[model samples]
Target: MSETFSDDLIASLPVLRRFALSLCKRGDLADDLVQITAERAFKSRDSYDPATRLDAWLFRILRNAWIDMTRRQKTQGSQIDVVDNPELISIDGRDVVESKISLNQTEEALTNLPDDQRAVLLLVCVEGLSYAEAADTLDVPKGTIMSRLARGRVALAKQLGIKS
Candidate 1:
């Protein structure tokens, strides 16, 4: 791969971090996951097919790494305590009281979702990927993505006491 390709991958770090944060729900853990994902992506760079979407490839790597880490943690009988970072919670120039309440509710709702449902919702709704693109990223069928997204949305709405 050319230097340009490496730069492009580097440019994706912020989005990767955001996705990681959504998955892990902890800033510190999300940063670590991003680092691991970057290292793995670099080591496996030669395996990357230029014909495929780079973001999708990197996302798959990150998701797989998180899965492995979760499995290891489970086997070890260890639990990670989620630490809330004030910086991560602050929304600049927004209505502080109302926005914070809404944000907290949304975050709580998201956390309540199953991993599979949350992954599809984050990829499609938060990351602005299309259903097909999200399906490709998660290695699921488009129909599966649609169903998960639908269920996730309904669940989130119910949690927020919104009428579906």
Candidate 2:
């Protein structure tokens, strides 16, 4: 069981890093977030309910860690630089460049949206989660998820200059 969990964690690292990157927009911080999440997940392995999706459980940890970091930084008042250590979270350069173009656009548009709408867009559009699954992950009503999804789509369309 321990070996299986270790293997699962290894497999999840890449996706988890991507999700963290989306949250932090910095490679080093995202890598740190993934590392912290892995440590927490390993330490609390027993607390993890097998019935729940492991990815969702991991995401909750990463999100909480990010929130905590942001809160701490409020007092520090200085941004951390993790951009130079790109090797820690290796992304193919060509793919990353292509992704950056779209990500920059999408992320900018996403930032303008309300938090609920941004989360819905990430879960549905980026993470490919179904509306029901997203609602479960977010602990919100399905209708709320749907409304956010609709609003997010409209916002993205307008931001991207789509005449719809």
Candidate 3:
């Protein structure tokens, strides 16, 4: 509605894109997700609680959209790979190449997790939401989120060849 609102939405794009990529693993799909998120947030702007974290709200919308898309496509597996393009590997000035390597490894590990565990892990660990916050976003009890996070971490460690 205002310049500030537009600015905030623009600032959130990168993280939203990254999160969408984690879910969809396709650049085009992730981009479409980001666009859908932006549009939903705009249309339902009045529903946003001023005191609540906008990022969390937007993430909830993105997660719902991802689920809806999955249902529509009847995805048999959780992971979705993007087209192989050299450009997706292009690092910008702010990227740490070594860290990116680690991130790739982590993504692979994440892919090995059950979809439920992966969603909880990403919302809490990668998205930096508190357990309660993540629980709220996923519409589960706090205890459920905690247990899923714990189990997800254990599963990730195993998948990554790290001892738990």
Q: Candidate 2 residues 55-98, lDDT tens each?
A: 99999989988886675566567654568665566568999898
List, residue by residue over 1-164, the lDDT tens digit for candidate 3: 46666788889999999999999999999999999999988888877786887789889999988876775465344543445554455556566877888789999889989988999988876666667668878999999999998999998988778986
lDDT of residue 46 for candidate 3: 78
- Each candidate's number of clashing pairs is 0, 0, 0
Global Cα lDDT for candidate 1: 0.87
Off by over 4 Å in 1: 79-164
Model 3: residues with Cα > 4 Å off, grouped in runs:
75-164
Q: Counting only residues 3 or more apart in sequence or on different chains, how many pairs clash (N, Cα, C under 3 Å) in candidate 2?
A: 0
| Predicted model with the maximum lDDT | 1
**TM-score: model 3 vs. ground truth:** 0.45
For model 2, which pairs clash? none
Quote model 1's TM-score.
0.48
Question: In model 3, how large is the Cα lDDT of residue 101?
Answer: 85
lDDT of 2 at 81: 57
Model 2 residue 64 CA deviation in Å: 0.5
Better of 1 and 3 by lDDT: 1
- Runs off by more than 4 Å, candidate 2: 79-164
